[model samples]
Target: GWTYGLNGELRKATRISGIEDFSINVFRRDFGLVPIKVATWGPFVLLNMDNEILQKDNIDTDNVASEWLGSSSELFSLNGVDTTLTYVCRREYIIECNWKVFCDNYLDGGYHVPFAHKGLASGLSLDSYTTSIFEKVSIQSAEGGSKEKEDDRLGSKAFYAFIYPNFMINRYGPWMDTNLAIPLGPRKCLVVFDYFLEASFKDDKAFIERSLADSEKVQMEDIRLCEGVQKGIESPAYSTGRYAPNVEKAMHHFHCLLYDNLIN
Candidate 1:
C-alpha cells in the first residue's frame, strides 16, 4: 500500500497485497523496504542505503556537498557556471582491474600523466599541477599549457575531483564529465562516464564528436596503465612499494580511508 499527496491536498491511497510494513520507506522499491537516504546537488543525485553510513549522526544530504567539498562547493551550485551545461553523452568501459586500482590510478595526482598520457599531458601545464586533500575529497587542478589552442580540448583550466570511494567529477574547459566505478568481481570493474557540455555548444555536432573522441583516447590510455598495475600486484614477487611523497598524497589518503572503513 502507498499514499500520495501534494501540499497536503489531493491525497490518495493505493493498496497492494504482501506489503507487511508500510513504515519501511525507501526511495527504490527494487531494494525492498530498506530505508534509503537521498541528496541532490544541482543535477547530481546521491542515494545511500548502507547501514554503516546511515547510523552516523548528521547524515543530512543538504550538508554533504558543503562538508565534503569545502571551498569547492561553489563550483556545483545551481546558480554557478555548471548551470550553463547540459548532458550530452554517456560511455561505459569494462576494465580488467579491481575497482580500487582504477581509483588509485586516478588519485596519483599527475605522476603518470606525462609518461602514460602524452597526448593529455601536452594540453596541461604539468609544472603547475596541484593536488588538495580534504576530509572526504581530493582535488587535482592544472592550467592549460603553452601549446593550448583557442579551441583546445581542455580549455584554460582543469579540475578533477574525487569523492571518497569510487566517484569522480572532471571539469575541463567547457565540458564536464562524471565517472562512476562499480566493482564486478575481485579483478573486474565497470566505469561509467557521463559527459556534459555548455548548452550553447550542444548543437555543434562536429565539436561534440571531436571532444568525445579525444576523451575516449585518454580513457584508453588510462585503461592500459591500470590493467598493467593490476597484473603487477598479482605477481608473487611483488612486494610493497613506496609512494612518491609529493605526487601520491591523495592516493595515500585513499588507502588510509579505505583501511579505516574496512577495519571498523
Candidate 2:
C-alpha cells in the first residue's frame, strides 16, 4: 500500500500576495508523514502554471509552483483569489527491493551488462572497462562490442553512462534517458525511465516498441540479478568482493569512497 496527503484547506490559510509570502506559510508547514522512500523522478508533483486563470490575475502561483517545482509542502494561498484552496496527496508503491543494494548494483554496471544483459550489450562486446573520475564523482564506460561506426549507422545507437552519487544517463539512439537503481530503502529501489528521440526514431513505431521491450528485459534482468546478489551477500559466505582490474573499477571506486567517508 502507498499513501500521500495534501491539506488543501491548510494551503488556503497561508495564502499571501507573492511567492515570498507563500513561502513563509505554505512552504514551512511540517507534514507528519516521514518519507521512508524517495526517488528523483518526473512528476513527483506537477502544477499547471502560465495558464489563463492563473495569468489573468496577479496571482502568486509560487506556493503551488514551489511544491511542483521542489517545494516539499503546500502551504500558500493563491495570489489573486479570495477563496480557500485544497490539495490531494498522491503516492504509489510497488515491489520489494532495498535502496543501498539497488544503488550499488546500479552504480556498478560491471557485473551484469555483459552477462545478464547480453541481449542489450551483446553487440557492445565489453571485454574490459575504463572510468573517468572527479573530485567526488566518476563516470564509467564499458569497453567495446560494437564499433563506434556501427553506432553512427544506427543513426543513434545506445550507450551507457553513469554519473556518480546516483544518476545514470542511458542514450538509446537519442530516445531514452533512464535513471536506474534509485534507492527507496536499504533493500528497495525505484527505476526512473524517460523516453525521447530524434524524429526518425519516433517515426518507427516497431523500432520504438522493440527498443522499449529490450529496455524492459534489461531492467528485469537487473532486478532479478541484484536481488539474488543481495540474498547472497547476507549469507556470511561472502563478506566482500574484489574488482577485476579496470573491469569493475567503478565498484572499487565506489567502495573506496564509501570506506573513506565511513571510516573518516
Candidate 3:
C-alpha cells in the first residue's frame, strides 16, 4: 500500500504467472523506487510503497497491470501451513536477593522437599527417595515412586527432575508436571506448572481444566514461599546457610554445580 508521498506513482498487481526479472526492473524504472519490504505470509505478497508517488500517479493495483501489460508476470502461489507452534508464559514479582540464592534452593529436592514441600513430601515418604544424576540433569524418585498403589485415588508419587540452567520437571503420579523457576532478572522469576492427563481423558475438557486450575494454585503457593525466601537471603547478616543432609540435597546439588561453573 502507498503512503502520502508521490501518490499514484506506486502500484501493486496480481498476475496469472510470476513476473520476470527484466519485467520487474522495467516496472521499477517507471515507479522510480524499489520495494522496501516484500513480505509473504501464506499466499499473499503484501507490498508497501512511498505515499506521495502513489497519489501523484493515481496508482492502484489496476494501474500496474495496465501500465505493464506484458506476458512476463505469472500467478501468485503459496504452500500450506507456513507457520510454527510455540508456547510462552510471563509473570513478574518482587524479589530481594541475588537470584542465584533462589536457584540453589530449587535445584535439589534432597534438602527442602522434606521441609519446604512438607505436604508434597508427606504423600511420598522421603525416606524412600533416591537421587539419580546425569550430566546437568538429576531426578529424585521415591523407591516405589513409579508403581501405582492399590489405593491410589489422589494419585501421588514423589519425583523431581532438574533440567539444568533453570527448569525443573516435577512429576506427581499421572497428575502433574511443574516447569519450575525461570528467572526474570537478577532477583525475580516466573514458574509454570503443566499437568498431564491419561489418553482416555483427552476429550474431557472439564477434567483437563480442573487439573490445570489445581496445578496453578499449587504454583502460586510455591511462588509466595520462594519470594519470602528471597527476602530472607537478602539480610546483611546472612552470607551462607547450611543444608539439611536429607532435606536440602537439591539445593546443595544446585549450588555446588553453579559454584563449579562460576569458578571455572
Candidate 4:
C-alpha cells in the first residue's frame, strides 16, 4: 500500500510480507507506482491524474466545492444534501448528442421547463425560478408552485446546481440526485443519474417509487430536447444563435468557460 501527496509524490509506502511478496512475484518486474491526486467531498471522490495542472492553475482541491458553490454553499447543507441523505439507486441514459448539449439544456435556468416539461413545470413556480452563476458553478432555484401536500413530490423548494464541466446536483423535496455527463464521441454521451433521499424517507416505498417515476419522466423529456438540438446544430440551416439574456446567462457562462479552457 502507498500514500501520495497532493503534488503526486509518494509520501509513504508499505507492504504486508507474505501477501505482498506473492503479488509482487506475479509480475515479472517490480510494480511501478503511478502518482495521482485524490480528494473527497462527502461521499464523492475526485481524482486527477496530472498534478501539474493543479500546480499550473494554483488550485487547492480542499476548497474546490466551496469555491465553485460560492454564496450558495449554505443551500447544500441547509437541504441536508451530502450529509443526511442515503443513496438509493442509479440510472444511466445514453443521449444522441454532445455532452455539452445536455449541459446547456440544464444551465438554461427554467426557460424550457414550462414548454418542454409541462408536468414538472406544474409543480414548480417558473415565475420564481432564478439562476446564479459562480466561478465554476451555476445554480437554478425555484419555489414550489402550490402549498406543500402530504404527497407532494416537489416539496416547497428546489435547487439545481451545476459544477463545471460535467457534474450536476439537484435537490428538491426530500430528494437529491446527481448527474454526470461523459462524452463517448463527437455526438454521443452517457448521463449517469444517482438518486439519494433523506434517511427518514428510505422506508417509504410508495413515496420513493412515485418520486423516481416523476424524475424519470422529466429526464425522458430532456433527452428528447437535447437529441433534437444536436440534430438542429448539425443542419446547414443552423450556424449560430443568440442567448436569452435573462434566462440563459448560466448557459452562456458555461460556453465562455469552455472557450477559455480551449484557448488557454
Candidate 5:
C-alpha cells in the first residue's frame, strides 16, 4: 500500500509479519523509522513501533499472546473450542498523571483492590488473585467472585498479562481487551482499551451493556486513584515508598526495566 504524504511524496507501506499477535502494516517514506510490530490477539489488533531499548527480549511462548493465534493453541481456548475470537468495542481513558503512575497502580497487586476499588472488588476475590513475574512479562490471575455467579457468560476466572514497557492484555471469560498505555508527556497519558468479544455475544445488548458498565466503573476508579498519586508525588513531604516483597514484585520488575533502558 502507498499514500501521498503532506508534502505530496508517495509514502510506501508494508506489513511486518510474525512479530505481533496481529498483522501490522504502515506507510512510511523510508526504512529509517522503527519497525512496526502488529499483534492480533483475540479479535483485537495491536500496532507497536519497536522500541530499540528492549528489542532484544526473549519472550516465552507461554507469555506471548501471539501464540494463541495458532490453530492448536490451548491457553485461551473458548469452552474447549480452538477458534478465533471477534472484535467488539473500545474506549480510552485519559489521565492527568505520569504514565508510570497508572501502570504502577496496576502492578501494585495488593492493598488497593480492596480499599480503592470497592465496586470492582465485589466482582473479584482478592484472596484468589496471584501474580507470576517473568523475564519481560507478568501474569495476574484470579477466580471470579460474586459477579461470576451472576453472569453465566463469564467462566470461573480471569487473567491479565503485562508486556514489558507499556502493554496489557486482559482476558475475562470469552472477552478480551488490550491496554496501550501511551505516554503523552511527563504528567499526562492516554490508556486506550480495545475490547474484543466472542462473536456469539455480538447481538446480546443487555449483556454488553452490563459488562461495559462494570468495566467503566473500574476504570473510573483507577483514574481517580492514579491521578491522585501523580499529584501526591509532587509533595515535598513524600519522596519514595516501600514495596511489600511478596505483593509488589511486579512493580519492582517494571521499574528495573525502566532503569536498565535509561542507563544502557
Candidate 6:
C-alpha cells in the first residue's frame, strides 16, 4: 500500500513559488485499510505494504522518527527580494561522464575553483570559502566578487548546498539555480540548471541578462572540467585517490554515504 496527503493549509505555507527542477515521485492507490503501515514525520509522509514488518522493526508511524529532509525548513525564502517571484530559466547539459564522477566533481567544492575556473576563481575568495558536513547534505559557500564586477550588490554571497545522490542548490545574489544530475548510462549524465530570481529584478533587463550570461559562462567552464575528469578516470593508471580532509570534507562525506548505502 502507498499513502499521500499534505494538509491543504500547510501546503501553502511550504510553497516554493515555483519548484523549478525539484522532482517528486507520485503514485496512486485504492482505498484499503487492510495490513498496511503509515508514517508521518515533519514534512515527510511514508507508507509500507506490511504493518507487521513495521512493528517488528519497532517503527512508529504516527510519531516522528527521522529528521526532516534537506538542509533547512524554509529553503525557498526570498531573503531581501520580493516573495512573488517565479523561476524563469532552465538550462541543461549532457556531460560524457559517469554520474558518480559528476557528483564527485561537484563535491570537491572549491578545490578546483581557483585552478580550473578562472571566472569563478576571480569571484570567490578561495581562503574565505568553507565546507560543512551535515547528516544528509553538505554545503560549500564563499564571500566573493568577480574581477570584472566586484560585489556590486549587497547580496553577493555565493552559497552552494548539495543533497546526497546528486541534487545541488546554488545561490549567488538574488539569483538561485538548482542542478539535478540524472544518470543516463555507465558514463553519461544529464545535468539541468533551473534558474530563479527576484520578481522585482525582472524589470531590470540588464541585470537579468547579465546574470544569465555569466551563469552560462560558469556552466561551460564546469562542463569542460568535468569532461576532462571523466577522461582521467578512464586512465588505467588511476584507480582511487585520497581526499584533503580540510578542503574536501564534502567529497569525503558523500563517499561515506555511498559506502554506507552499498554496505546495506
Winning candidate number (lDDT): 4
Candidate 5 residue-wise lDDT, 1-264, digit = tens: 544555544454445445444322323333334444455544445455557523754434344454433332344454322236566778998899999998898887756889887766666677888887766766677777774343444446777767788987778766777798999999999999988777888888898888888788889989999999998999888888789887888888899989999999
Question: In model 1, how large is the Cα lDDT of residue 101?
Answer: 96
Which is the winner by TM-score between candidate 5 and candidate 6?
5
Report the lDDT of model 5 for residue 147: 49
Task: Name the candidate, 2 or 4, with the larger lDDT value.
Answer: 4
Error of 6 at 124 (Å): 1.9
Candidate 3, run of 10 with poorest lDDT: 72-81
> What lDDT is reached at residue 33 by model 6?
29
- Model 3 C-alpha lDDT per residue in residues 1-264, reported as the tens digit of each score: 432234333344446236565354454456555434334432224354656553554335544422221221111011011122111223343444345655665655545556555544545665776665555556666633334432131254445666555665544434434354556677765554444444455676675566555555545555666677777777787787566765556566676778898999
Per-residue lDDT of 1-264 in model 4, one digit per residue for the tens? Answer: 666555545555576446645454343234435545566666577676676753454457768567546666776676656766799999999999999999999999888998999888888888999888888878889888776432277888888889889999998888889999999999999999999988889999998998999899999999999999999999999989899998998999899999999999
**TM-score, cand. 2:** 0.56
Error of 1 at 125 (Å): 0.4
Model 5 misplaced stretches (Cα beyond 4 Å): 1-83, 146-155
Query: Whole-model Cα lDDT per candidate?
Result: 0.81, 0.49, 0.50, 0.83, 0.71, 0.68
Please give the ranking of all candidate structures by lDDT, highest first, separated by commas: 4, 1, 5, 6, 3, 2
Clashing pairs in 4: none
Ranking by TM-score: 4, 1, 5, 6, 2, 3
Stretches off by above 4 angstroms in model 1 are: 1-35, 50-62, 67-72, 75-81, 147-151
Clashes of each: 0, 18, 39, 0, 6, 0
> Model 3 shows how many backbone clashes?
39
Q: Write the per-residue lDDT of candidate 2 for residues 1-264, one digit (tens) a residue.
A: 222345222333333447553542444354234322222223222234444633343334444334332331221111111122111112222325665565567566466676787655664545544455444444454434555433321222334445445555444333435364556666666666655555544566676666666666767887788788878887877887666664556666666777897889
Off by over 4 Å in 6: 1-85, 146-149, 152-155
Error of 6 at 128 (Å): 0.7
Question: Predicted candidate 4: what Cα RMSD to the true structure?
Answer: 6.0
State each model's C-alpha RMSD to the native. Answer: 5.2, 13.1, 16.4, 6.0, 9.2, 11.1
> What local lDDT does model 5 show for residue 57?
42
Better of 4 and 6 by TM-score: 4
